[model samples]
Target: MRTTDTLNVIAANSRVLVGPLVLLVVLLLLFVFALRVGIGQIISLSKKVAESKVEEQVLSQKLEILKTSEESALPLADLSLVAIPSENPALIVISQLKNLAGEKGVGLSNIEAKQTAAVASIFHTEIEVTVEGEMGSLFDFLKGLGSISPLLTLDQVIIRQESGIAKVDALIFGNFAPLPTTLPSITSPLDELTAEEKDILAKISSYSQPVFTEVTPSGPFERVDLFNF
Candidate 1:
């Protein structure tokens, strides 16, 4: 009878311990999961910080270059824009051609200038020029075209020795690059101008730009707005 009582008490104690043991197991699992999540976040953040340090080094070099080259950059940029203008170069090209003809002692017999239509590449226009003069004068005029600005290129030329005339087909290039919508990333690589690029800049800088005459509109001489006047 005593043995049976002892067994019954032991069974009751075990039943009571079951709930606490299960609760402890659940708490342990939650603690482990929390630790894993915290470790993962810490590793990700550490990696980002390391990458940022490298980017910072690269950016520092670029900053130094910008500081040192600011003076030269402006003039080169201006020359580049003039070399490949952002607007229609038709008028300036025609003016240069006419001026060049006179300077080279050639008479402009017939001139036709047209902007290229939006067929494939609309970044250029075309001009047809006919000059009449001696062979030497025409040769000088042809040679001078490359030295003038608005970036003119003679694509086709036909010369008639007997008639003392030359028909020239030329292309005038323009730059219509759109402004950037977003700033570049800090990690973006900064490259110095290569030898070829520097050579191109030098050639472009040497090209002579046409003198533009701005026509200012005159106000009404008789004063149309009498009350205001």
Candidate 2:
């Protein structure tokens, strides 16, 4: 009878401990699962951070490129203002000359334009102008032409005084650049000006102005015949 009683007591103790052991096991499994989920979230966040860093670096590089482009654009804009387009260069020259002559109280008698041979990717256009004005006004007009756009070069000048008025025949040359099909590659923005370009600009600025001011024309001047040769 005592053995049977001891066996019953031991069995009852085992039943009580069984529930607590199962609960501990469940808690341990849940902790393991939560730890695994946390680890996965950390890894995903790390990957995102790395990708963001890479994108930030790429954006920085793009910003630098934009800065360089901005700097380069300024000089190119200045150059384009003086560069001649591939359009009707003769009309442009004639109009510019007529306006300049009228401003300086000069009379434009005739103008003739001829296209010369291309040299070094640049096309040359020759303009022959016959002008009559006072000697001082004629000199001033010639000087002002040097400072004008599309860059004129006075190849020859013949001047004679007729009845106290100067009659001048000038052979001027202008250049036009052909339109480029392919875009040029520019690596840096801080490029130096070429020697030839510097020299040309210097010459243009070195022209002397006349001591006295000539009266500008009040009305439109007489139109001169423009012939293409």
lDDT of each: 0.74, 0.74
Candidate 2 residues 50-166, lDDT tens each?
A: 977877776666567557656544345445534465644666677778878878998998799976757788777899998898888999998878766666779899998878878
TM-scores for all candidates?
A: 0.75, 0.51
Q: Which stretches of candidate 1 lie over 4 Å from their true place?
A: 115-123, 161-186, 213-229
Q: Write the per-residue lDDT of candidate 1 for residues 101-171, one digit (tens) a residue.
A: 88988888556767664434336677777777877887888898889887776777777755435544334
Displacement of residue 94 (Cα, Å) in model 2 is: 0.9
